[model samples]
Target: MDELKLGLDLGAVAEALAAGEITERQAKNASKFINQVKAVHEKPLKARLIQSDRGQFLGEAHPLDCGAWKAYRYGPEFRDGGKVFPSLEDAEQFIING
Candidate 1:
């Protein structure tokens, strides 16, 4: 079997599998290999600390890959408030206000 290249789209592989062009094992292997490669190359999103006007730490905001930002309130544990913002500024505001 040919080695699957990095960044292979699993959608195409699924289509191939459904079309009976590739075996189930081959499709699973391709998916696993692609995910492994993605995991190795992808880095965790670092949350930027949000501060108040008085220089007090509010919380943190992490930018997502989908052009959105997620805010987490700082406390005993960093917890997401179940809200997604369109921009980092919006997320920071949420952290500050909430």
Candidate 2:
């Protein structure tokens, strides 16, 4: 996986804590902050995003077929039972913009 750039300043947080400008709790919270990261290397579908002439993006179900690109989690049964995209467009936009 590629390293992600988190635009945060650890030194600044340390300085603020040292100067008593921020609580130790706040500094600790800042230090432990996590950014959401998800990989989109696989298709939400069985085919490529731009497969043959029958691209799903152009089908009648285009805008609603979000299972292809949205992130999801499997239950203990490995079922499709976790978070899903609100729409295909939203997922596509996120991938394109990010």
Candidate 3:
């Protein structure tokens, strides 16, 4: 038998172990690792850089901004408190157009 050694190869093994075969310890560890990976990838959206007569500003490219813009533009509190967004497409439009 070939003993292939691997370091931190929990992703594949944890997924392949299946529900019945995975022990409590493995489940806990796998969940932790998976969450860590998720957090690492959950980077914030890029900020929009603008230069105008007023000078430069640091703006964000996000749905909340778009929602607020929409609300302000159309006179409706649609994206209030970050609770609602019709779609990212609408949000993205504001980001680009503004």
The C-alpha lDDT values of all candidates are 0.80, 0.43, 0.43
Please tell me which model should have the higher TM-score, number 1 or number 3: 1
By descending lDDT, how would the candidates be arranged? 1, 3, 2
Candidate 1 worst ten-residue window by lDDT:
1-10
Q: Write the per-residue lDDT of candidate 3 for residues 1-98, one digit (tens) a residue.
A: 00101233455546545645666666666666656666666865443343334654313333354443221222233234222336654544543344
lDDT (tens digit, per residue) of candidate 2 on 27-96: 7766555222112224343422422244433211123353454432222422433234566555444433
TM-score of 3: 0.27
Q: Give candidate 2 regions above 4 Å deviation.
A: 1-7, 34-98
For all predictions, the C-alpha RMSD in Å is 8.0, 12.9, 10.1
The model with the greatest TM-score is 1
Model 1, position 61, has a per-residue lDDT of 83
Write down the RMSD of candidate 2 (Cα, Å). 12.9
- The lowest-lDDT stretch of 10 consecutive residues in candidate 2 is 34-43
Q: TM-scores across all candidates?
A: 0.49, 0.33, 0.27
Please provide, for model 1 over 1-98, each residue's C-alpha lDDT reduced to its tens digit, 9 standing for 90 to 100: 35344547888788878989889998999998878777766875477988999999988887888989988878854653647899998898888988
lDDT assessment of candidate 1:
0.80
